[model samples]
Target chain A: MVRLLRFLVEPLVLPRWWQDALLLLPRLVCGYLLAFEFGAVKFGLPWSPPDHSLGLFEVAFWFPGDVASYGGLFAVLPGFFAWMGAFSEAVGGLLLALGLGTRVSAFLIICTMLVAIFMQQIQQGMWNTLPAAGFLWAALPGLVLGSGRFGLDYILAKPRRHEHV
Target chain B: MNTSRLSLWLSLGFLLPACVQPAHNKTVVYLLDVRGIPNVQQVGLRGRDNPLSWDQDLPLTPVGNDSSLYRTVVTTRTGYLVTEVKFTVNGEFELQQADNRRIAFGAPGDTVVYRARFNVAGSLKP
Candidate 1:
């Protein structure tokens, strides 16, 4: 048991940036898959309810009037938020794929995921809750490490603009 | 720049659906402005057995009447639900329930049921 624990905690012998790359690739994939799922469930060729989610109508009616009202903003905002959310997830997913401005895109997507979880999937319990939290966790690592391997950030780190042969 | 333009078009696409009315006749208009708790469930009133396929699963607002109360409506040919809202939630937001004797429109002096849980604010104009 102690040996397994030590192995798990042991410092990676690989360069720091390589470690970042290993961590980043999986996160990028998860983010992309999650975004695809969001679009499929909400706006694909045939829209379907999320695997364990309540319908939009049901979620809207669960809150107190004043909060739900949004003082007349409700008429347009929900749709707007939905659009923004889908777009963010879709685009953020792609950007993360290439490791371009990953931190910023992930942050925006993290906020979007939070709104989705809170407004639509709160009752969905841990299954829904963990994915939303995962987006945040994945994002924090990007913010800490910046983009990795062939990313715009890495390219820009070159001392001169025309460094290529 | 190309990506941004694509995003802008997608934004417009998402909005287009909300602006137009869906073809499915009698619109189940949601009256209350609550988030998270839906107050309207549009069940089809077709055939004698199990008209409501709970699979459609429109969330209904639970009213705060002392006793259990429910309201169901059949859709007109136009597909508009001649909606009958029921109010039957318990606790601080309790509301008086309307008589459940008949499934038709209530006449003057007859009990009128509100079709969801409600707080003691915002009087309806009609």
Candidate 2:
């Protein structure tokens, strides 16, 4: 457990500037893609396509209800659980992009991708799993690393608290 | 951070149940949603069933009091089959879930009931 924790927070051996730039690339692209593109369609935002009526705070309930179609404990309160999953993806994705609440947002993304990978994608095929797995890997580091120096998380953090990263 | 971690753990605790969708061996009933459509003419289910192409659609029957819920029952020869519902709600044909919904009719000879839901607020895709 201690070794796992150490690996999670292990500082990069590279110079601070290089480390910041490397992490910044994924942090920006993945965050923007999830927040601006996919989440908008499913959860709704100013830029959400005008065609579908899925509005902010609403979920694509059919997916959760689909989960319930399993016909077991999954059938109970499927809507509520579904809403939580959607919320994590849409809202959490946005936060991840902005690097606000970095740890928390990363945690949410981790859970959502875990389900996407294990529950849905594994059954489909490797191509389907690859994209989610990419985000999953990116978010995994963010879960422990938090947002790096180039993000809002850095500015919001206090002095001498570099350890937070 | 401690509060946030606790909440994350709590959220995981609640979400754990959504992960248990095992394949069941049963003759399953799939209930699709046709609720709250502003105007309607007709509705049906379409997909790999009946015909490989979605050219043909299966009709849905309404349940008591709720005009929105529609249902259908099926037994399986094949393993896992996916499908979508098409509503001729207002002259134009609209499909549910962008046709993303699916069903596992379970293993042959088992019986169970499952529900699927979809809603279109206004206007169908062109």
Candidate 3:
């Protein structure tokens, strides 16, 4: 179990520290905007707009309906998917920002972004897909590299004294 | 995942039930026809109600595949016989009209549908 946990938490260390620092920039910016701005508007969080009157963890009233409009499978269980999508953005973004469970968070973010781009925004125009596309691109590296060396995953995955022998 | 991350996910899972709120006994559906209005401008509502404040604007979502139609639903525990409201374009109230639009609600457990055209008075459907 410990070995499996280490494999999951371990990050890919880059040759240079500057590479990790460079990667952190987009993760921080996208994660902050996702958690505080985009996700907060639709999902219930502590920092949601006062006028919205959203309780903690509550999905905004209109969000489920909006998700249903995506049609097919999304329409079948809109509420569940809406809650999951919002959770990925609001909570997954926070995890991404903290550099904890970076691969899992990135995977969730990537799925939500794909739906936002193709199902929702594609019909409107390419320009409409840019925001989701940007987030998708930002998460792609995290999915592969697991937050690099600048994240909590690296620290948590470091070999302990007992493991050294 | 590490123990800390796994615990965090579990805690969030426990909070999932809170995402669904109790159903409101009263519902008001506001539909706006924006065919006459510019597409670039965002349409919203400012009303005197629990969900709406006279000072803040509540943005309306666009109806499916229709750029000229927008809708919003406000649900409350108590019903109001009549509520004064005004539509806004880009956060600016429709001051060109002489009076604010009025919405009348039905009895408890009833859904009231209010439809009106932007910037037009007396355009509400019966």
Candidate 4:
């Protein structure tokens, strides 16, 4: 049993760089699809106000800091949170695609998704919840798997040197 | 493939700012069903820095007896119910009537909610 298991799994052990490349493919594809799918809709541009088609709950994360309706505690809270989230998903997804800053990008994506989940759960019964849930489901595993197999990180693999006599 | 991914991200970074711009104020519309009667409410500009303050309510323009569709314009300092901003029901759904109307606010990201009581019914045209 040991021999069989080793034979089946041993060849799969890839160098760190290759591991990263392998990880990059799916991340990049899925990230692009999500971005494109969301971007295609005429929701609103990144810097401006949201549309009514999007409920306050939907655009909860994107609300800007400097532009609060009432000036109490949550004044800039929504906007700042949204700003961070948009940048993360947009840039983080892109980075994941490139495998350039895989860890950082994945971290940001994860954070954004978490915020999204929080908003959805708090708000409750919003259509936006599904996408957030879906992304989170896919992203956690991707984060664990990481960029592997055939990524740039693979090229940067440490060179093996011969020991001097 | 790795190089391709790198290029894709680099290009996206350059394009992001162009795709997003700050709104003069926030624009939010709610197809709310208060009790059984439907009401369309439009919040003009959500303002720049305050969420609570941005909750300023605009006039509820009655579009139909259903009240699911209305129109208004809003901003931080001022709001015009008819002029700058306009409102109309995109469409209403019987099946989704149970589901709330969805809208986006503040920044343009993928977020939408279906208000429980409120339902989008009919078309904006009529």
Best-matching candidate per lDDT = 3
Off by over 4 Å in 1: A1-17, A40-76, A124-127, A150-153, A156-159, A162-165, B1-126
Give me the displacement of residue B30 in model 4, in angstroms. Answer: 20
Q: Which ten residues in a row have the lowest lDDT in candidate 3 chain B?
A: B16-25
The regions of model 3 sitting more than 4 angstroms off are B1-18, B21-126
Give one digit per residue, the lDDT tens place, for model 3 in A1-165.
977766667899889999999999889887888899988866778898765557788787667777889999788667777888998998889889888999899899999999999999999999999999999999888888888888899888878878872
* Superposed Cα deviation of residue A30, candidate 4 (Å): 2.7
In model 4, state the lDDT of residue A133: 71
List the candidate numbers ranked by DockQ, top first.
Answer: 3, 4, 1, 2
Enumerate the candidates' DockQ scores in order.
0.05, 0.04, 0.13, 0.06
Q: Once superposed on the true structure, which residue ranges of model 2 sit more than 4 Å away at CA? A: A1-14, A70-73, A160-165, B1-126
Q: What does candidate 2's lDDT look like per residue over A1-165, in tens digits? A: 955544433333335778867876786777777777766655656666553335456554345655565445457656555666666777777777776766777788888788778767788878899888888777765676766665566665533555553
Question: Looking at model 1 chain B, which ten-residue stretch has the lowest summed lDDT?
Answer: B42-51
* lDDT score of residue A46 within candidate 4: 41
Residue runs of model 4 more than 4 Å from their true location after superposition: A1-25, A34-62, A65-79, A126-128, A158-165, B1-21, B25-126
Query: Model 1's chain B TM-score?
Result: 0.23
lDDT of 1 by residue, A42-152 (tens): 432223233213233221111222123433543445555544555566666666656666666667777776765676566667687787777767765655455655355
